[model samples]
Target: MITAIVLIQTVADRLTEAAQEVADIDGVAEVYSCAGDVDLIAILRVTNHEDIADIVPGRINKVAGVLDTDTHIAFRSYSSQDTEATFSLGLE
Candidate 1:
């Protein structure tokens, strides 16, 4: 699976609606309203790399109130859940 973290810039007054629309887009796994340079973050996952474009600019960017976006494709996932599971392997 190809995973991308899309930082979204939404119109100030339309954040809530923008996020909801983003969440409804296909290939979008999750959307977060956050505090930072960007207003929202969207987690996009798909089977093909090219699909990222289809999902991002093709769909996501067209949503109402979405002003701009920056996409970062994940090379690896090192979540705490995965780390904890790894450390617990031989402790049983």
Candidate 2:
């Protein structure tokens, strides 16, 4: 799967509504309210890279309150559970 980390900038007054709308979009796996330069972070998982292109521009950008978006494509993923297992060594 292709994973995209989308950093969103939304109109300050419409942040919640914008986030809710983005979360409803297909292929968007998760949405988070964050503290930083970006207002929201959306995790998108799709079968093809082209899907990211379509989602970011065709849909997300068109959301009413969305001001801007920055997308990052992930080549690899690591989860804390995976790391914990690696350190366990199958020990009891």
Best prediction by lDDT: 2
Instruction: Please name the candidate that would achieve the greatest TM-score relative to the true structure.
Output: 1
Clashing pairs in 2: none
TM-score of each: 0.88, 0.87
Q: Compared to the true structure, candidate 1 yields what TM-score? A: 0.88
Query: Please, what is the whole-model Cα lDDT of each candidate in the order they appear?
Result: 0.94, 0.95
Over 1-92, each residue of candidate 1 has an lDDT whose tens digit, in order, gives 99999999999999999999999998999999999799999999999999998999999899999999999999998999979887886755
Model 2 over residues 1-92: C-alpha lDDT tens digits?
88999999999999999999999999999999999899999999999999999999999999999999999999886989868987897867
Candidate 2: stretches off by over 4 Å:
83-92
Clashing pairs in 1: none
- Lowest lDDT 10-residue stretch of candidate 1: 83-92
Give the RMSD in angstroms, all C-alphas superposed, for model 1: 2.2
Superposed Cα deviation of residue 64, candidate 1 (Å): 0.7
As a whole number from 0 to 100, the lDDT of residue 34 in candidate 1 is 94
